[model samples]
Target: MKHLRFYFDVISPFAWLAFAKLPKVIEGHSVTVDYQPVLFAGLLSHWGQKGPAEIEPKRAWTFRHVYWQAHRDGVPLQTPAQHPFNPLALLRLAMACAPEGMTPGRHACEKIFRHVWEGGGDANDPARLQALTQALAPGRDPNSDAVKQALKASTDQAIARGVFGVPTVELDGRLFWGVDALDMVSASLRGDPWFDGPDWSRAAVAPPGVVRPPKGNP
Candidate 1:
């Protein structure tokens, strides 16, 4: 059996796509998806990268690409009422709800994602968010110290591990970023030589410092 840790931020459209496809991907494969909540803004800050809403063409493309892909893949997706909204409450609520096992946690994550994105609702509205969290977690307090600490720990650990994006999975020291990487993840899990493609392995022969390096490291 393979156990994988899925780090996600509910505000991410791609993360919603991952949630839609995960169940089918792991069915009968003896795999378990551990739903983990990490702040997308936290990742953006640490990586020194701009999010879609903070950029021009990228912001436009993010919505277009997600909707197109979701349609093509038979997944439901809709733009949220607010873009780049604060997700602290949602993140803490997910961690707080997911104490027992994978199913309940995945369900909770899906509910939050669908409510905010697919349902075109405002997750930032405290009363609404609190109601949603209460339904999933029952008495769990997003403002409580325990939930805050857990959320912090998960976000800090995600940064420590190479998770600069949502819908990322970590297993056996291998980090797969983005929903597109799930295919490679499955191949690797099947004990196949997943990277047999020619020359792609050597695509990064030069160090980033010499190969169009970014301004700074996280």
Candidate 2:
């Protein structure tokens, strides 16, 4: 089994940031990264959660925060022209490229992310999508029934496995969400003695309040 399963949506700047940082995170480790594409809209619908882009300060903060992190990580940052465009075609294209090899899928993903997020391009444009698929997957067709079905199945599998957001890393039945979790992913890959750490519950103390909080919730 692959040590790291990364789920992403090209619509997410955080996912792009995480994807950019993955090369460094996986370096010097034997862990493998299995990149899987899922629709952010679908996950939000299934989990009854709102996307960051649909909210106020979060939507505004999302872009600013990720750009800061991208600069910090020496990764280029670009915003998309549309806030929440349909990703169906894009997801299918990525899955189509996947059959050829990881590189094709990965490069396709990077190109899409760069063009949409970095170049502020409209991802919903069919001509733009076809050009990417042609270059990345050769004869692959993104709008094909087969590609659409495959992406949907893969996305459903991600949702069933408790994936609720982009840039989620699944390992050993545990899920790590966001770029911040990459450190934990690395630690797990290295078999660190304190990877899971000790249960602090035994040495915990209650915090002041109208009513005391739960053991690890205070």
Which structure among the candidates has the greatest lDDT? Answer: 1
Off by over 4 Å in 1: 100-104, 195-205, 209-218
lDDT of 1 by residue, 23-104 (tens): 7777668887788898888888988888888988899998899999899999988787888888887887777775532222
Task: Determine the backbone clash count of candidate 1.
Answer: 0
- TM-scores, one per candidate: 0.87, 0.83
Off by over 4 Å in 2: 100-104, 196-218
- Residue 178 CA error for candidate 1 (Å)? 0.8
Q: In terms of TM-score, how similar is model 2 to the real structure?
A: 0.83
Residues 113-202, model 2: lDDT tens digits: 776776677777768876776667544566777667777777799899999888898887778899888887777777775545563233
